[model samples]
Target: MYSGQSIAITGAGGGIGRAMAEKFLAQGAKVAISDINTELVEKTAAEIGATAFTCDVASEEAITAFIQGAEAANGPVDVFVSNAGVGFPDEPGGHAAGGSNESWELSWQINVMSSVYASRALIPGWKKRGQEGVKGRFVIVASAAGLLAQVYSGSYTTTKHAAVGFAEYMAIMHKADGIKVHCVCPQYVKTNMTKGMTEIKEGPGKHLEASDVADSLFAAIEKDEFLVLPHPVIKDYFQAKAADPDNYIGGMAYRAKTIDKGHIPLQ
Candidate 1:
């Protein structure tokens, strides 16, 4: 689907990002991949026949450099994937629970502000090009936590919500401008992020692979859809949450109390 396009993905060193890079390459796209880790980024890029750039999406300067370098190496990026995110699972105090301010700030920067940075940099160019019949795409790799909520990690849930909101705003505000926006909300995937996470408990669907998410993402992009729910069950869960928030919150609390080792209180 991405044939003859220039695609750039942040956090492409491993997991979903790497899977996306591989998928796009197989579809004949010029892929530019970046990650905070220089070694992994180089390795993934080489393995996938993509351009490699070391980038920390948490920093605006780094993001700018990555975009510039990727464009130079490939071409003007037709699609930019803001797929980098971070979370601390077992921290004592996190999000609202008295976690250190630094952790919260990091989560905000990586999970939320990274997409913001991409929009800030790309929207103007995309708008100008869109006026001339050229369109650009932005994809956000958010979590299902963005739609419902997570029990143990406050930072992940809160920042993912922000990410989803930002993606929605971008899509709603720019559809007329020919700028396509997609937000990917997936349940637990067997990625590095959920490596040691055992609180997952019994879920409707089993853990997904990174490739599964990449496939779902491109399918949504092809249809110009705003939201990509890889697990499919998340769509129903999200609708349930929207239909009755109080009942949804109560159910979530019950699940957390029953399955989460964090011992998070309902109050």
Candidate 2:
């Protein structure tokens, strides 16, 4: 389904973004990948046969510039993946909202508004294409934290919820405009964001490689699905969350007590 189409992804210097870019390239798509790290993105592009653009997704101007550059290099984008993300642990405080204002602000910019800015830039053209029967896809690499919680990171959890909410908003408001939205909510993936985190080996949850996450996305696309869950168990958890809010809260309360054991982010 991806052959000869233009695919653009953010945070493609490594991890899930890079894996997604590789998958698109293998499917005969002309891919454009971007990251805030210029050297790293350029190197990844050279190695993976994708066009490179350095973009700080936190900035609206930078995002638009990246889009224009990608279109110039590989035609109009058929799929735009807002895969770039960041995580910030809560500060050492007694309350749940311990993260600094700067951390919360940065988290909001990167995790939520980045997707909004990209959608604002792409939806106009996508609507025109949709009217002609060609639809465009928008993918957001959110976290299971959005549906549940990230324990130590209030900023990460809150902004991810916003990210997921934005995806829903786009799906509801712009589906008629030829916009297809997919929200990816994975539990724990082996990415730089999860570096040095102990891998889960037992139970319903497990650590996944970045490529595994990309494969899940392809599967969702094939099935014409909206929610791309790399970790299937997340769906069960989400359903349970909706089923019983009290038990879910108590369970998370207990999990928070031990999150530092192996769930603490290295960075």
Cα lDDT over the full model 1? 0.85
Clash counts per candidate, in order, are: 1, 0
What lDDT tens digits, residue by residue, belong to model 1 across residues 1-267? 578889999999999999998999999999999999999999888887999998999999999989889888888889999998887553653335665678789999999999999888888887777335448999999988899887877877888999999999999999889888889998877778776555344566667889999999988877768899998899998889999999999998888668756333211
lDDT of 2 by residue, 81-197 (tens): 999999988776547887789989999999999999999899988887733644889999999988998888888889999999999989999877767899999888888888888
Model 2 RMSD in Å is: 1.3
Best by TM-score: 2
* Candidate 1 accuracy as TM-score: 0.92
- Candidate 2 least-lDDT 10 residues: 258-267
Q: Give the least accurate 10-residue stretch of model 1, judged by summed lDDT.
A: 258-267
Q: Which candidate comes out best when scored by lDDT?
A: 2
